[model samples]
Target: MNMTDSEKAAKVIEALKAAEGEPAQIALPILNGLVGLVQGGGEAPLEFEEARSGAFLAICEIGKALHRGQPADQLWAPAIAAAERWQALAR
Candidate 1:
């Protein structure tokens, strides 16, 4: 589905309210929403955009590790850190 930047930002904010669990284990929709805010069409700052990519890479790493039967913990530290960094930059 296609959505404007405003629509994506709105979705991200709305989802954030309902995503009050482990930061590492955040809902995929939240991550999707975030990607919407940072993609090629997005106007996010370089730092924010980079942080978004880092968060995604961390998630992918966790998935790969899990597929290999290795223990994975949300890629918690890296993902959460990237989130915090981007959030700060966005502000």
Candidate 2:
């Protein structure tokens, strides 16, 4: 049975809630990979844009985890730091 995207996302969120240790360890590499694809600038600009959109969705999911009271230091510190650096670069 094929799950819809929302179902898949909900499953991932539930897994993250039950996860032990640093969730960032699992999440960051994926985010970094998406960012790399966006920044790499290959022939498939649309694919890169899709990757960038995925990265944004990942960031939102992380933020949702934070809002749901995941420990900031343990699960999300690196993500927060990376976001800060990105903001700094933008300014």
Candidate 3:
């Protein structure tokens, strides 16, 4: 059976907690709240999937940057450049 989005988020939370560090500290609560949003039906303000993806992307990138001893802001440079290129391309 496929896991629900909340289930997936919970799994991520479990792993993050096991990893135990700044990423866990920062991301754990966000993922905890995300579980509710996933179950929140149509009443939630933001589309939970979009919020989930963006938050996960930031967490992964920030983790990578920190692991490499680079500033967390390092992700913005490539992300912005890629976004601009994607925007300019015909859909």
The clash numbers for all candidates, in the given order, read 0, 0, 0
Q: lDDT (0-100) at residue 62 of candidate 3?
A: 48
Clash pairs detected, candidate 2: none
Model 1, C-alpha of 11: deviation from truth (Å): 9.6
Query: Can you write out model 3's per-residue Cα lDDT over 5-83, one digit (the tens) per residue?
Result: 5455555444444433445346445434433323323433344534554545644564566566666555544433332
Q: For model 2, how does the per-residue alpha-carbon lDDT over 5-81 read when each residue is reduced to its tens digit?
A: 33333443334343324455665444443333223233434543454344345455665565565655543444344
Stronger candidate by lDDT (1 vs 2):
1
Q: Which stretches of candidate 3 lie over 4 Å from their true place?
A: 22-46, 70-91
What TM-score would each prediction reach against the true structure? Answer: 0.51, 0.31, 0.42
Q: Rate residue 16 of model 3 by lDDT.
A: 43
Q: Indicate whether candidate 2 or candidate 3 has the larger lDDT.
A: 3
lDDT of candidate 1 over 1-91, digit per residue (tens): 8865445434444444444343434544455445545454557667657866665576456545545656556454665565555555555
Worst 10 residues of 1 by lDDT: 16-25
Give the top-scoring candidate (lDDT). 1
Ranking of all candidate structures by their TM-score, best first? 1, 3, 2
